[model samples]
Each structure stands twice: as structure tokens, then as C-alpha cells.
Target chain A: MAERALEIRSESHTYPIYIAAGLRHQTADILKGLGKSTFSAVLIVTDETVGPLYAEEVAASFADEQPLYICTLAAGEQSKSMETYYELMTFALNCHLDRNSVIVALGGGVVGDAAGFAAATYMRGIDYVQMPTTLLAHDSSVGGKTGINHPLGKNLIGAFHPPAAVIYDTETLYTLPEKEWRSGLAEVIKHGWIQDPELLKVIKDQWLDLSAVPVDVLNDTIRQSIQVKAEIVQLDEREAGIRAFLNFGHTLGHAIEAEAGYGTLTHGEAVAIGMDFAMKLSGKVLGSSLDSEAYNEEMIRLGYDLTIPASCEPETLLAHMKRDKKAAEQKVRFVLLQEAGVPLVRPVEDDTILDLLKEEMTI
Target chain B: MAERALEIRSESHTYPIYIAAGLRHQTADILKGLGKSTFSAVLIVTDETVGPLYAEEVAASFADEQPLYICTLAAGEQSKSMETYYELMTFALNCHLDRNSVIVALGGGVVGDAAGFAAATYMRGIDYVQMPTTLLAHDSSVGGKTGINHPLGKNLIGAFHPPAAVIYDTETLYTLPEKEWRSGLAEVIKHGWIQDPELLKVIKDQWLDLSAVPVDVLNDTIRQSIQVKAEIVQLDEREAGIRAFLNFGHTLGHAIEAEAGYGTLTHGEAVAIGMDFAMKLSGKVLGSSLDSEAYNEEMIRLGYDLTIPASCEPETLLAHMKRDKKAAEQKVRFVLLQEAGVPLVRPVEDDTILDLLKEEMTI
Candidate 1:
């Protein structure tokens, strides 16, 4: 299959995202093309799960001139913590990595966030490339938002350090677990609901079993989702304006993830549920004309659990959402859809969210 | 003395610097004028020495609407490390400081670098105000260079995160220790050597006794130093080009400080020695006519120890210099002065640096 290349243009940096079946083996050639000779060392940050499987292959692609070091973290959301971040820094320092050193983040979003942040602060910022092994990383790889989670919340500490490049090898998806595929598909569905109704229609009509989707359709969908994210991020690199639209389901999604104690559910799983709540809230508040029943049918067919867990209390969830980074002036602000593709960020009262949560819990 | 305000215009942000004798007491008004109402909380990151003396007064300046919290680290260069940085992040999280929160860095360069770095990475970056209580902070507060020291080296990890505003209360300098006064003067003299020879002459002629300099003269000298720093930082916020000149003596200065152990010798003291070596090296290698005798005399009169300690080996110092962030491809780069106000960054051969260190040790 021909490689599909897309560019993300931001104020501080402009990088390319290459989507292909077997691009990880071409890491050296691609990096060399992006001025790799200046680098003296390469530190590959991956998770325990992904490291044993692919880190060596990626490391082999590098020329022997630049020595390679690998640092692996536990494969889960827990690794995206300040402890892990500091440990990565110490490992990089111990390896004698200098300013000219490059960090290759070769895993899913967790590894990307932790490693990218380490690169951002290591030596006051260094270059890093993203070799995403999971479908979820496609969205994260395009944006320069890299961070570690705080005990109080998710992604509470981070920096906007864009990757030097993103090499997305779709071939890795063949080995991805079924649950991981379901988790990643939620974000792809989110991209469609937030900004691309046409893409949403394509998914609804052609793809129901995410694991069985054809290669061409999967690549096309991922590229379209990334383009939507890239365009939004390009317009507002710092999330000062329209970029908040990308958080359509994240306000509640993050609250659920935090309340559920991260790892209890995947990021996409929580977001899928959040999207359901958002659609219901939009219909009641914004009088949005979204077809709720049809959307629910599609989600159910695609194997998404849209129900709020019994253990997650509505009050506690509401409290968690208030602490979200997107909150303003002590109010819970959410990104609600006006229709399928028309999204709006507005400050919603606590009582309204509480009522919606209570109502959604029963469903 | 009337409050003097200067604007630092950088491509990423434009913020004001407030310098006066007791501006710390007016923190609230100053912050309000700069749009403080938007903030939900304020985190004051100070040091043990400064916190006990002034944290309360600074905290009282804020309105009750925005809750205040204080986190203090030991008052020394040793506090500027990854360990301290992690502790501060944990404190901020415990206080529930959110995205709209602001961090007030209230101490010397150590607190500024550590606290500024925390703010830079917290929630992917937040606004931080520099309430510099030490003379050395005047140089550090304006440049937006924030980072923690690594065990391997001094300031080996950091970022270019400019503060929202700088509140330099000169009154705080009155209580500063004599050694600190001498330590900070090195940077002031460095400002003169790199960009303002007239200011250098002024310091030599009018302020031979740093402790005895009149308040008016001291304030004028600080503003002049800051102006030189501000102009260079404005042109290069990221240290990509001419901004490197700011590291006039930092390469060797950092090496000496690291070799001597963090708190054994102050930053400015080491830099003073570095300046002495750089001037001699300039005369020998660059064929620049720098008045080494006059420069050494001024340094001595200003109470700067211009000698390398016997315990710090030349080889170790040379090795540390090679690991400096400014070094490229194993070459040690120095900001050599062709003449006063005409600085150049050139790659110096390792052998040349080794010989200079050996010769300077005997001096």
C-alpha cells in the first residue's frame, strides 16, 4: 500500500505524519532525511509490553554512529506519572545523552506523553520522534501536547513539545488486543462526531466490527481523523480558542477516567461514554438536533459500553470535572455538539451536569 | 525611588518587569493590573531563608478570593535539582492548584529556576510571576530560562519559560549576605563585558564597594544590566542565535561550579573566575586586545576571587565544559569577547582549553 503523508502546521513547528503498513523498519532513513546526523545519541522510550516486541527492530534501523539506549516503563496509564518522568530523565542523563540527543517514543499514548515530556524538559528541550504502535496515538502524535498525570488529575503536568516526526506503522495494529482496538476506535469516532460528519457516515455505513475493518478503509479513516485534529491544533497551538472544540467529550471523559482510577477503563472507553452524555446534554440544553437513538445503535453495534459504572457517583464525577484544566472561574465547561459536526464549548451549571449524570447513570 | 517598569518583548509573549524598593508589598495591585482576576489560586514557591522572612507579607497582598499556598525548598543552589522540582509538583497537586493558578517564585535564581520550571510544565504550562529577592535573580528572572540542576551537571535540564511579570523589590537586596552581593555582581560585570562597556566602567569607578554603593546607583546599574539582557532575549527567546552570548562565562563558570560542588562556590563567583580565564584566552587565541590587567583589578576590587581552586582538577573541568548544553559534536564552545561589546561563540579545541586550564591553575 502507498504511504499516506499528512502535515501538521503549528506556530512553533511543522512536522509530517506518515501512515503506512511497515514504516517502523524505515525509521533510520526517515530520521536521516530529517537531519539525523546532528544527533549523537538516540533514547527509545517504550513500555514493557511494546518494548520486547518492537524496540530492537526500531533500534536496529538507526546507524551505528549514534548509539541507542532504551528505557521501558510499565505498560499502562500509571506509568504516566511524575515518578516515571523523573526516572526517564535520570536514565537519559546516565546514558550521557546531550542536547543533540534524540528521544524516540515508540509505543502508545502513555509512552508518548511520558517520553515526550522528558524530551521537552531534558536539557531544556530536545528533539523527539514518534513511532506510534497503537491506533490511539495517531491523534496524540499530531498535536504537540505532551504531559504526565498528577495524582489529583490526568495530564496535570506537561509541555507543548511537538515531535520531530510521526511514523505510524499500521502493521502493528494486527497484534493489538481486541480491547485496545475498541479503546482506540472511540477516538476515531470522536473525530468524526466533532468535525467530520461525512467521515462519521462512512464509519457507520462501512465499519461496524473495528477489528475486521479493511486496511484501506482503516488507513483512510485514521488519516481523516488526524487531519481534523491537525487542522484544529494548527489554528490554535495553545488551545486558546477553537482548539477547545476538540475536547467535545473530554470534560466528562477525563472525570470518569480519573474517578475510575485510570486503567480501570481505557481513555477511549471513558470518552465513548462521555460522548453519549454530551449528546444527551446537547439535546436538552443546546436543543441540538442530533439523532440520539441512531447514534446509540451505531455505538452498540461497534461494541462500546455506553453505560456509566455503578461505582462512579454522580457528585464525585461532577467534582472531578470541575478540576479539569478546561474549567474556568469555578465553573464546569463542556464541549457540546450543536449537531453532529457542529461543536460548541460552553459553561454548564453544576446542577445541570448533576441532573444529566443522574439520568445517564440509570441508562 | 519611583517604580521603574520595563517591557520584555519576545515572540511568544510580552511581559513587564517591575523594579523598585518594596514592590513586593504591592504584589496584589501589580498582579491585578496585569489581569490577575482570571486566576483561581496562587502558589508561592520560595526558599527556607526567604520564606520565613517575607512569605507572609507577599501572601497577604493577594485578595482572599484567590486562595494562596506556599512551598519552600532549602535556600541554595542545591535546591535547584530534579528532586526539589518533583517535591514542588507534589505540593502544587496537594494544594489542588489547577490550570488557572499562578505560581509566584519568591527567592533567588534557585527558586526562580525550579519554580519557573514547575509552572512551565504544570498543566502543560501556566503563568508564573518572578518575585526575585536576591540580586542574582535580577539576571535570571528576565530571561525566561528555567530548569533544575542534574547530578551530572549544573542546569543540565531546563526550559525557556518567561515569567508573567518580574517583581524585583530592591529593598530585599538590603538584607542580602555580602557573598551573594559579590556573587551577583559577576553577572552585572558580565553584562558590561558583553554589551555595555560604559556600564562596566561605571561599576569599576563608582561601585568598587558593592555593599557601600548608593541605592540610586545600584538601582541604575541593575536596570542597565536588565536592559542588556532584555534586548538580547527579545531578539532570541530560545537561545538559537545571538542569545548564546548571554553565556559569556557560563561554559567554564558552570564547570567550575559543578566541580566545586553546588553550594561551595556561588554561581557569580565561578563566573567571575570564568570571565578572567575567558579574557586571557581571548587575548591569546582571538588576538583580541582585552585589558586583562584592568579587568582583573576591577574583579579584585569588587571582591571576586579570580582564581581556580586547587582541588578542582583541570581535566575534570575541561570534561564538564565539553558536556555543556552549548557544546556541539564533542566540541567545547565558548562565548569569546573579540573586544568589549563584541561577543562571538566559537568552537574551541579541547587541547586549547586543556592548556588554558593548566596555565590558569598556576596563575
Candidate 2:
């Protein structure tokens, strides 16, 4: 097991991200080492699937240092919801968690989001640590962007509360299915395409097959992906400017994910398609010489369905894109990967967007 | 009309607090003058009572500056419920408000709290202007403590999101009832008792009569009261240290307010009682000659009901006091104004608190 550490700085504070295999067993010492040992109580928020697998081991890591409480939610993207968020608040209050308490987000992206949001709003914000159990969580576990989805839009309700720390235990990733591996890889690849083109080469050369990535490679991949996000977050903690670049494929990816109805497609799968579309649009609109066909083939080789679901219409996606929280004056802006490696965010005409969508539906 | 401005600086940004007559009518130009001219949309969150009285006037203040929307909740402390907060989020979404939009928290503390909370968490927070319609809101509008009450606690779910600015329209105070004046005056007096004794002299000399406060006197009083809070908040934006001093009476006052059930007694009325009790405790526990009887005499003269109503059990209040969110390891600490003007925060034993409660109940 290789141990790697990265530091992220937000406006309020600086926290460390610890990526290692078997860190779960050493959670107590790590938290103490980071000087975050005083927790009045601990609330471990894990999804139902991960609760049975890893929640107890994580709870034992506390070893009665503070009273521990567990809140398990229904698994997947659907758990990132208002009802669940509200219920988590009640549960925290009922468990006698107070200002000094720390919330342990002990599962995947959905758990991190739902639990991170709970930590964000409970008692007007409390400290929380990300104990990410899945690969998809590597992106969410950093950057302090915590939120739940609104019925009308994804992440319309949320906060930019950075976690006290991130303790990423890679051992849990072994239990993840092949689909989950593919799902998590999109954001990992996104980090490559937007920030560091070098990150893509690591995946391209050694880990094209998602499930068979080596341990040292996985640790490096997680650190590099997180470093890209952390640097963006460090520069713009509140998404004031550079952080929007992190939303490279998210402009279309979010609309596609939301229009397809949450859980219909894993976020990475939707983003993989979004990334493909962006390259194609960039070549067509920005006159970038990026090979969109080659990009599509690469995505296909990595096992992504680039085809837009017939049930999710282009018009509906356009509407959702316009409704993205970043939109001001109903302007539809996208993070276009214009030259394969370079991404730019600019407003594209609705007609141009609609035409692109219409063309995608035919395929 | 005379206008005064006070600047408040939080960790994120510095926002101005404008105290004036008819500022609501001049909102458009004022926002433009302050360099906050672009609002994609404006959502005015008022209560049912204040909505009919002043929401329309405030909305008209925008005057084609941006798309305008209003969300009116049931009036009073009951309106600060999780259900109402959730509904407000849905309404903001349905209104197509994006992150660029601003929320106008119009009306009393209830509205400021619920609406400011919505502003704080809506799309991970947006800018909000505090349009206070009640004297009680003078305290709430300044500090940027925004939240909805959990069934178990007051302001348990909230954020420390300061408003973009506070637009305090004094003209709205003209329509307030005597109970409202007395209610708001308690906080005014609290500022004097804890921070600056000069504040008490202003109220003690000219405005002892709750209903007949002259306009200039009222303006001066609001400024002084807000200054006390603004200074405290400026020093400790996140309630880290000196800010807790602002909760001088709130330790027991909040317990009493919650135990009595919200809206049972006006917040100021409850705090009035808590202040009296705090002085009493300060005298008994800290051996300070702060003159509790004179404080009681002054409060009674100001038209406050100092009686504990015989129904709110002292034991219940003790339990609620222990559950105060600031409690760590169940140790109850309170900001005690031991020497009338100087306040101190230190842990008080449960026995001492229970004994004090029992003594108060007998009276």
C-alpha cells in the first residue's frame, strides 16, 4: 500500500487529502495527526450499500473516543435529495450532535454530497471529513462543493463548505463493479482533458481497462485528479472564475444527467458523452483542429455510450442547459474543449446549441 | 429624510447597512449607486402579514431593474420551520432564479432568518439584501445568522452568510404595534447591558415609553443598537469568540423561547425575561452587584411581561439550555453579564443552572 498526501487551501482554511490503501484502519491516528481529534460526536453518513460493507469498520476506528452515530441513506444519485437532506438534519439533532461534532461522509459521491450538504447546513455549518469509499468520490471529496439536488435542477441547493480533511481509502474500490469503475473514470479523464493533459496519458498508457488499474497507479491517479480540482478550488474557492473550467463537460453533462432523470446514467457516463459532444462542437464552432472522431473512438474504447437516449430530447436538454444555475440572462454557456487539451467557457447561440442537439438525436 | 450608513465586513465581503426613511422606494438607484446593479432576478421573501403591508412597496422599489418574484411565508417564529424553508427553495427554483439572482429578505426576524437561510443555501448561496419590516429584525438583519428552526431547536439549520447589504427602511416601523416596539427594545437594551451602558441611557431617559418614541430618537437608537451587534460581528464574523458575547441573554433566552414553543412569546419578550434572569444569576453566582431589581423595574416599566407564565417548567429549560448548539461535551457555557456592562463566557455547572431555574419557577 502506497501512501500519498495532497494539501488543499480554501479561503477559510487549508486541509489535507490523504490517499492510501488501508487508511480506514488508521483513521483514528490520521485524524489526530491532523489535529482534528475533538469531535463531540461522530455521524457516519453512508449509503445502504456501503453501510453494510465498510461503515462498521470505520465506526470502530473511533473506538469510543466520542459517541458515534450512523445515518444510512438509500444508495445512488437519488439519495442526493431534499427529503434525505432534511431527514439527515433531524437525525443529527436527535443524535445530540452539536457544533463540535464532525460528520464522516463514508461512502461514494452521493453520500459525500448528501452528507456534506448536511454538514454544510446543520447548525449553520459544521466540520466534516470525507472518507470516500468509491472512485467517483475522488472528484467530490475535494473542492468543498457540497450540495443536494433540487427537484427542478441538480445542485440547485448546496454550499461551498470545505471538508476538514479527506481520508481516501482505496481498498474499498476493489468491491466496486466494472460499471462503477467506468463511471468514476470520466471525471478522472475530465481532470486530464481540462487541467493537465499529462493525467490523460497515465490513463491512456497504463489503465485503459478501468478495473485493472494497479494500486500505485490508482493512488497516483486519485492524487492527480484531486490535485487538479484542489488547485482550481484553491484559486477560486467559490467558483468565481477559474473553477468553472472544472465544469468542462458539466455544461452539457449536467443537463443530460438531469434530463435523463437522475440515476438513469452514472454521472461519468453522461459526462463521457458530454465530453465527446464538446470536442465535436469545439471543432465545428471554434474551428479547433481537434479530432472529434478520434476522441469518440477513445471514449468508445473506454466503454462509454456516446449516443443520446431517445427519451432525453435535445430540446429538453437545451432547456435544462439554459436553466443551469450558472446561466444569467438565460444565456447558454459551455466549457468547450476546443483543442483537445484546451477548454474555454463562452456563450453559444441557442440556435447553435439546438442544431447540435438535433443532430445528436438523429444519431 | 435623514439617511445613515454603517459598513459590515464578513469573511467573504463587506456590505453596507442603510438606515433611512423611504429607502425602499429608492432601492433601484441605491443598488446602482452601491455598484450592485445587476440582478438577474429578485426574489422578495416576506411573511403573510408584512407582504400585504410592505412587500408590494419594496417590490416596486426594484422598478424594472430585474425580474421580480415574491415568496410569502406564514408570519412569526412558526414560519421558520424546515418545511417552509424547503418550500422556499422549490419556489426559488420554479421562479428560475440562478446564482446571479439576489433574495430580498423583507419583514421581521422570522422572514430574515428563513429567507436569509434560503439565500445562504440557494445554489450554494446568493446575494441577499435585508429589508427589515419589524424592530425585532434590527438585531437579526445585521449579523447574517440565517436559518430555519429544527423541530428540536431554534436556528439549528442555518448558515453564517452575510447579506450583500442591509436596506433598513424606517418608514415601515411606523405601522408597527406597541408590542412590537417593546419586543424590539429588549435587544436594544441588551446591547446596552452587555456592551455599552450608554445605549441604556438613551432608552432610559427619553424612550422609556414604548409607543411614543420620536423619529430622530428612534433612528439614533436603531443605529446604536445595530452598532453594538455590528461591532461584535465585525470582530468575530463566525461567532468564534467575541460574537458569543452578543448571545448574552440568549443562552437561557433561547432555551426559554424554544421550551415555551416558538411564537408563544415575542423573541424580545422572552429575551427580556432571560436578561432579567441572567442579571439575577450574575448576582447570585458571580456575586456582582448589577442591581437585578432595578433591571426588573426598568423592564416592567418598558411594558414587558417578566413573569415566567408558571407553565414553562424550569427543568425543561435546563434541559434545553444543556442542548444549546455551542455546548461541547455537554458542558453548558453562557455569556454572563456579571458586572452589568462587562460580560464573560464560562461554563456553569448543571446544578447551579437547575438551582437558578428552580428559584425562578418559585417566583
Candidate 3:
């Protein structure tokens, strides 16, 4: 397969993202080409599930170079916590990894976030590379937003430490479970909805059964999604402006994930539902002319439950949204679509949100 | 006393350093003048000792505009640990501090480093102001280096998050204990040794008893020391080149501090001994023509112990030095001075270091 490369340019740093199948073996050569020869050691941070499968292969690539240490955490959102981050730092210290060392994050978003945060802070910032094994990481891996979750919220503590490179090997996705595919596809769907409506049309026209999608189609979709994300991030690395559009569905998405308890639902599952709610709210509040019926049918066909759980109270979710990092002066800020490919971030009133939640519950 | 301001320009950021005797009352105005009107809340991170003494006054400055919360840690080097850092993050979360919130580090280096690190990681970086309460902070408060210490070494986990402004009120130093004065003077002397010999000569000529030094002289000396540090940091924000010069005495100094245990001996005291050892080593190894006898007499006059403590073993200190973040490939790197203003950073072999330890033990 031919390799495709994209450059993400930000004010502080610019790095490339290489997408291809079966490129894991090129990790060391690619890193050396990027001017990383002075590192004394490499710490590979992965999850237990991914560790036993691919870590050795990646480590083998660096066999002749500096010593490589693998630090594995349990696989899931629960692993993205302060406790896990602290343990990873301690592991790096025990390995005697210095400022000259490099950290290789070798799993999905959980491992990437935890490890990237550890690298971001270990010795006051070091270099890290992202070798994302999951399709969802196609979005998370590019931007420099590395962090661990607080009990009160998701990604409340983090840093903008961009990865040295993102080496995405689609071959690894062959082993992904069907449910994981549905979860990852939600983000791809989100990328299409926010910036590239044509991509959404293509996804709808092709790949009706995500579980059995063609490899070429998957590769093209993932690449397109990353390009949208990279363009937004490059323009606003700190999220001071246009980057807020990327959170079109994440405000309520994160709340649902937090209220549902982390890992109870995959990130995509929550985001899918959040997107449904946001579309309805935008229609009522902003008079957005989105084709809600068509969007809902597509989401249901893609294996999503668009209903808010019975256990989750409207008031509780509203409180969570207001506490979101985007909130200002106790007002719940939201990214509402004026139309497809045109998102607007503004503060929504509590009474209006309550009304929307009541309406969502009836559905 | 008149106010003095200096601008530190780096590739990543530009901030001001305001030095005066009574600027504490103007904290809020200074921040507003710097265009910080959007903050939803202000978090004051201080130590227990300084919290009781000055936190209320500082808190009162921000009373009308935004909500204020104070999180205080114990006053010492031991507080610069992961446990404290985690607690600060949790506190910020509980207070609902978001991306727009500002963190005011209202104490010396310990509070500044710990709080600055928290702000750096909280929401992937936020704005923070430095309010230096100790003269020793003249060095730490200027640089963008912020972090917590690991059990393995000091500042092993951190980031280079620069402050938005540094408000130094010399009035705070008047209440400092005599021991704290001696502790802060070591860094002042170090600044003189590394870049400004004229400053060193002035210190030696004017101040015999550090405890009784005139307030005007104290303020002038601190301003001069900060200028030296600011000039160097402006040239190298990430510690890539000229920044290593600032670590002239820190390699061995940090090892001694680690071996002695944090807070057992003051930081300046450790640096003083480290400076003495580096000078002697430079004379023997680099063939430098430094007058060691005259320097030692000056240090003794300033109430510093020029000899390595009998309790600290040479092999142990060497082991600690090898673990420093600056160490590469098990060889300890030291910042040695060929003369008063010419510094060199290079690796010293294990055998040579052991032999130097033996020589120093005999003294």
C-alpha cells in the first residue's frame, strides 16, 4: 500500500502524520529520520491488550538502538486517571529515563493520552510519538491535547505537547472487535458532519455494514477525518478560536460519558447520542435546517442508541454541561450547527437546555 | 522605593517582571493592565506560612471582579512532590476552574513551581502570575520551568510553562527569617559568579552581614540577579544552548541536595558547596586559573560551609549526580567553570568523579 503523509502546522511545532497499512516496522527508521538520534532511551507506553500483540514487534525495530522499556496499563477509559498518570511517571523514573529519552505511545487514545501526558510532564516535557492502534485515535492523535481525567470531568488536566510523529498502521485494525468499529466510526461520522458534508455522504453511500467494511474504504475515511482535524488544530493549537467547532458534539458527549460512568459506553456511543441531541437543539434554538430524520436513520443503521438512559436525570446532565471547560459564568456553552458544515459555539440558557432534555427523554 | 520593570522575550512568550517594595496592593491592577479580563475565576496557590501572612491581602485584591479560592500547601521542599501536585489538580477541579481561569502562584519557588506546574497541566495550560515572596525566587520565578520533584530526583516531572507576569514586592522579604536570607543569597552569589563579576564584587564589598543588608541594596541586587537570569532564559527558553550555563553549580548542587534530603539544607547552601566543588574541579581538570583560596574565604565570610559533609558519601553523591535529568548514558554531566564567567557542560567519567570525591573528602 502507498503511504500518505500530512503535515500539521502550529505556532509552536509542526509534525507529520503518516498513514498506511503494515508500517509499524518502520517506527525506528522514521524516528531517526526525524532527528531523534540523541535520545538515551525509549519508553513504549501501551495497554495490556495491545502490549502482548504488537509491542514486541515495535520494540524489535529499535533492538539495535537504545534500550526500550514497555509500560502497560489496563485497556479502557478507566485507565485515564491521575493514579495511572502518576504510576507511569514513576515507571519512567525507575527506568532512569532522562530528558534525552523519548516516549512511544503504542495503543489507542487512552494509552496515548496517559502516556503523552506523562511525557509532557516527565522532566518538564520530552518528545513522544503516537502509534495509534485504534481508528478513534485518528482524531485524538494529531492535536497536542494530552491529558488524564479528573473524577469531576474528562481531560480536565493536560498539556498541548504535540507528538513527534503519528505512525498509523491500518493493518492493526483487522483485529478490532465489531463494537470497537462502531465506536471509532462515530468520530469519523462527527468529522464529516462538522467540516466535510461530502465525506458524510460517502460514508452513508458506502460501508452500510461497518463490521465488514473494505480496507481501502476504511483507510480513505480515516485519512479524510484526520485531515479535517489537522486543519482545525493547525489554525488554533490552543483552541482560542475556530477549534471549538471540533467540539460540536463533545460538550454533551463528555457529560453523558461522565454521567454514564467512564467505560460504561464507548466514547463514540456517547458522542453519537450527543450529536443527535445537538441537532435537535440547533433546529429549535438556531432554526438550523438540518435533515434530522435522515441523520437519525443513518445513525441507527450505523449501530447507535440515540436515547438518553433512564437512569441519567436531565438536571444532572445539565449540571455536568455547565461545569464543562467551555462553560462561561455558569452558562452552559454548546457548539450548535447552524447548518451542516457550519457550527456555532454559544451559551445556551438553563431553561432551554432543560426543555431540550425533557424533549429528548420523551423520544 | 520606585518600581522597576523588565521584559523577558522568548520565542514562545513575552512577559513582564515588576520589582518594587510595595506592589502587593497593586496585584489586581497589574494583572488587568496585562489584559486578563476574561478570567472566570482566580485560584491563589500558596504555602501555609505565606498563606497566613499575605494570602488574605492578595485575595482581597481580586474580591470584586472574580471568585477567588486559596489552596495552600505545607511550606518546604518536601511539598514539591506528586502527591501535592495531584491534590492541587483536584482542588482546581472542585473549584470548577476552567480554561479561562488564572492561577496566581503567591509564594516562593516551591509554591510557584508546584502551582505553575498545575496551571501548565490544568486544561493543557493556563495563564499564571508569579508573586515571589522570597529572594531565592528571583531565579526560579523568571524561567518558564515549572514542575514537581519525583522521589528519584528533583524536578523530574514538569513543563516549561512561562508565567504571564512576575510581581515582586520586596516588602515580603523583610519578614523573612534570617535563615531564609542566607538561603536566598546563595543564588544571588551564583548569578554573580556565572555572568556578572561586577555584581559579585559589589556584594562582597557592601554586605558583610546578610541579615542586616539595606533594603535598597537588597532590591537592587535582586533586580540585577533577575536581569542575568532573564537575559539567559530569553536566549534559550527550552534549555537547548545558553540555558545550560545557568546550571553551572546545579549538577553537583542538586546531587548534594538529593543526598542530604530535600529541605534538610537550604537550596542556596547546597548550591554554594556545589559551586565550590566545581571551581576546584575546573582548576584541576580544565587548567583554569581561578583563585580558589580567595573564593573560599569569601564563602566562609558569608556563613557557608565550604567542605562536603562527612555524613554524605562520595559514591552516593556521584550516584545521585548520575541520575540527574541532565545525565546522559550513565555518565554524569557537570557544568564546570573555567573562570568566573566562562562555563562548560561536559560529561565527567565515573573514575574521575570518584577520584575527585576522594580528594574532596580529605579536606
Return the lDDT, model 2, position B242. 85
Cα-based lDDT for every prediction: 0.85, 0.84, 0.85
- Runs of candidate 3 with Cα error greater than 4 angstroms are A1-4, A259-264, A310-316, A325-331, B1-4, B260-264, B313-316, B323-331, B349-363
The TM-score measured for candidate 3 stands at 0.93
For residue A71, what is the lDDT in candidate 2?
A: 92
Candidate 1: residue pairs that collide = A124-B158
**Model 1 / residue B238 / CA error / Å:** 2.5
- Give residue B136's error in model 1 in angstroms: 1.6
Docking class of 1: medium
Residue B86 C-alpha lDDT in model 2: 86
**Residue B87 deviation, candidate 2, in Å?**
1.8
Mind giving the per-residue lDDT tens digits that candidate 3 earns over A305-363? Answer: 88887778999998888755443466877889988888888788889989999888986
Q: What tens-digit string does per-residue lDDT give for candidate 1 at B143-214?
A: 888998877666777777888889888888988888999888889989999999999888877885787678
Error of 2 at B141 (Å): 1.2
| Candidate 3 residue pairs that clash | A124-B158, A124-B159, A158-B124
Tens digits of lDDT, candidate 1, A1-363:
224389888667778788887788888788777744668889999999999989999888777877789999999888997778878888998888977889999999989988999999998999999988888888888889899887666787899999998988888887898778878888888889988888888898878667878877878888898999998998889988999988878888888887887778888999999998999999888999889888889888888888887889999998778654443456787899998888998878889999989988886
Q: Write the per-residue lDDT of candidate 2 for residues A169-280, one digit (tens) a residue.
A: 8988999998889888999989898888898788878785678788889999999999888878888888779788888888788888877876798889999888877877
TM-score (chain B only), all candidates: 0.93, 0.92, 0.93
Output the lDDT of residue A20, model 1. 82
